[model samples]
Target: MALCPISLSLPTLQYFYSEMRGVDQENEVNRILGAFKLNPYEQLGLRFDCDASALRRQYRRSSLMVHPDKCPHPRAKDAFEILGAALKHLEDPERKSNLDNALSFAKEELLKDWRKATKHDAGVRLAASLDARGMEGVEAAHVATPAFAEAWKARSREVLGRAEWRRRRMSKRIKEEEERGREEHRLEKQLNKNIVEHEKAWEKGRTERVGTWRDFVAKKAKKSKGGPVGGIKPPKRLRALLRCYQQLSKARLSLLVTATASAGYVAGSREQIDWVGLGWTTLGTFMAASCANTLNQVYEISNDALMKRTAARPLPSGRLSRPHALAFAAIAGVGGIWILAGKTNALAAELGAANIALYAGVYTPLKVLSVANTWVGAVVGAVPPLMGWAAAAGSLDLGALILALGVYFWQMPHFMALAWLWRADYAAGGYRMLSLVDPAGLRTARVAFRNSCYLFPLGLAAAWLGVTSPYFAYESGIVTGGLMLCAAKFVSSRSTANARLLLYSSLVYLPCFMLAFLAHRKPNDVDDRLELVMGHLRSLGLFRSGVDREDEGEEREEDQGRVAAGTSGSDGAQSIAPTPGASRPLPPLSPPILTGDFWAGPMVGGLPPRGAKS
Candidate 1:
């Protein structure tokens, strides 16, 4: 047998080695896919304590084994990518340090657990006794035992699992915080960009704005020289007076206030209409409103100059001086209170004074301070109707309260719509309105809608309280229902079109509702109603009896005898002679005496005397 072993061919050995390498790559891909995903060290099959070079070498080996081109496994690509990511994580100094700390902490916990168990376990104690005689430390020798080694492995895995979970949580939290910071920074950058663009645009238009203002001034100057007024040029004094009127008050709003006062007076009147009283009440209310409005413009001059809607106002446009405006307000205020106190009652005068103070003192300053100023403004709007009622009735009664509350509630939807439509202007003017704060308009819409709903019940309450007939409720329901629908549409769309629709609806609703109320007004006299009640009670024998009834019968007989004697005279004529001891019938009731230009009208026939024939 001296022929010896035959030499293997090099190509055959290379082919076999290639087959083995392919099988090894497939196996590594499976192992990587099966490893714990949270821990990068576990995925790469590298120890947590491994240095950057060692980690890099292991990652390279693992990645090559699971490379998609080399491995036949379907998940080879995923394993290769995962191995690359693990290498990147371990390469970072901070990440590597955190992992090392986690591993050290896990090892320390495992040793502590082991020592605690060994204190009670006989087998672990025997292992520790043997370690006492050996060169290794007792804890290390104990960990070398099969039982302690199994426990240490489990405890280390558990501790590393907790550490990985904490790291994932921390990473998620940090990412969220970074995202929030980036969003805030982006918004700030956009805001600054917008401000710069706005300033640039304003600067570009400066020359045009100045030219337009000059043209306006020239036109005004020409008008003062001699311009067409009501188809004919007026005298200088007349023009100046008209200009003063325009500067002192808003005519349309003042007229609306006077109309509301007239409505309240008519509603509250229980007897024949007091047209003279109505005139005085309306005039006084208008003057007070004008005073308040002028004071408001005076206070908000600087703020008004910023808003496009208010920039052309008298005070802001420099058409009216502050001192002149103040003087006008003072005269209007004093004159208004004087008229109310002298022509109307003291209560109406006090209410007028208080309303002026509320509007100019409290509401004006509060406009820039709080969103609640809108509600305070509603209260100011309410006082006019109450003043009218007090002027006619000489007291604040339940009917007056209902009328005032209607005005109060109506203003919410009306002004809320206006506020929403002019939110940008309000913001520019530095006023704190609800619409300005509620960017989405949810709150403003809710407020408007809620107040509109209140109108429905208020109408019913007015009828229930005998302020108006039941028919007014039906009419008011239809009107307020439309307002509510408009409000709801605004809430749904939050668009300018919907808000404008709501505003128009509110404007229509007030006039229609007031008209309906006036049409269905219950105008029964208080004295007549009270007399009827007393007569009914007496008929039921609840009031008078015996001697009182006899005295009433004798008085009735005596009145009948006098009437018969007067009628039975030779001529069929009315008697004008006064009885010696009989008290004369009370004179016809009339309105309080008027001074100055006003004169009391003759008393119109009302209900007949209490016991007289109809």
Candidate 2:
């Protein structure tokens, strides 16, 4: 769409709107005014002095498309009214400038009111007073402190109320202007009808050339000469700079994932890790994960371009060519494997390579086919910690396997929370996150809570039996697990805001508890290896060496039987409620899109449109 030749002149436009919405369209002056509204003074070909009937016909056609009823919105009630008013103002030369002046003046008055109203904010006032002495331990003067505080509080309310009132007043004024615009539009409709009839009459009589010198000049001015033969233009140096920036961003993401994964490796090995080997394993895992992320992006470029949020990303936006992305992927992938093989044990390097291949080559595509992709993604996500442990321990042992399981189990809740926040984006991009499909959020919340619940005993057992640390297990069980349980309880609220709070809680809980375990040390606490292994097994819910798969299955049934038997005939036995927020799943932060007010949910309003929109 070419921008109108006329200046934006919102103030003038505001004036025109007030005069447009009349029901009458037969007046000559009204038809001319409608033409002016349709084509402003700066338009190259359109003339204000045209015969009225021809212009009237043209505007009537346009009104159909611009009518409020045709283009629906939440606030369609006043759309046509505003358009009519603009037409009305333009139809009359006398009041066009008057309309502009009133609008300009009204805007200024409202802004002034707004400024005065927001001059005192409670948070700011409280902060100032507290900071004057000290917020940490406020020790301000005690001279009539209560009275002063009370006065301040009252004044703050007054100011805040004034601000709110001013905002409402501004909205009302805007609505009023729309009404005036409707009357103007009605007037313009008349002028248009007259201009169009005049044009028809002229055309009826003409059997020969009828081009005016003005028409010829207007036609010449509209043409733009162009020369093109489909030759491609190379990206400018600045474009190249932007490409580098995107690569760096991807690199930065890789570095962080690697570093965090490395931390786990180091932390995992404190019990039985070889320090030198662990360092090598960290080197390999970091490179491998980074390589995989690059590959995943390269593969998903087509899908990314279809998502609003992802469309502007490097590969999808054509910032970097496919070959370039491919080359980067290979370099990262090959270099990462090399690092792992050279620095860590062969087993660590091999596992790292396998994970990368599985994630990028297999699971990445699985996202489109199955929601079980979450499980696949988790398995891939869990590989890094094991890579770390293997880097230190040189191979997978029972303890390392248990530790890996913990990571696999932890990912569901963490990613589900993220999926809730980005549900729209996932749905828009056609990425299969559980939260996207479950609008009720019941299944998402249940799975999230259940996964967290199961982790409690496993985490404690990992610490107690010496798979990790006893202190870490107890702390994880009592504190982190309890916090998750509380967050789970809140997931059944009617507002996505509560779900959003739970999502935040979940994100916080994982990292904090993981760090807590890493920070604990329990070396040499027990002398006998046999006794230590036995303790670990018992904590893990294993009775003895004789226990097999069948026995373990039976034990689980018996435990469930106890729980079921105890809860029999009781409605309160259920651990969690359904759809905490009524029907809508969790949202992110605050400010729900459906609600006028701001609150948080898992996936809030900021994500891209649905998957079908390019």
lDDT for 461 in candidate 1 is 78
Candidate with best lDDT: 1
lDDT of each: 0.76, 0.58
User: Can you give the TM-score per candidate against the true fold?
Assistant: 0.58, 0.46
After superposing candidate 2 on the true structure, give the runs of residues whose Cα lies further than 4 Å from its correct spot.
1-256, 268-279, 523-531, 535-614
Worst 10 residues of 1 by lDDT: 594-603
Question: Please, what's the RMSD in Å of model 2?
Answer: 31.0
Native-to-model Cα distance after best TM-score fit, residue 120 in candidate 1, in Å: 33
Steric overlap count per candidate: 0, 75
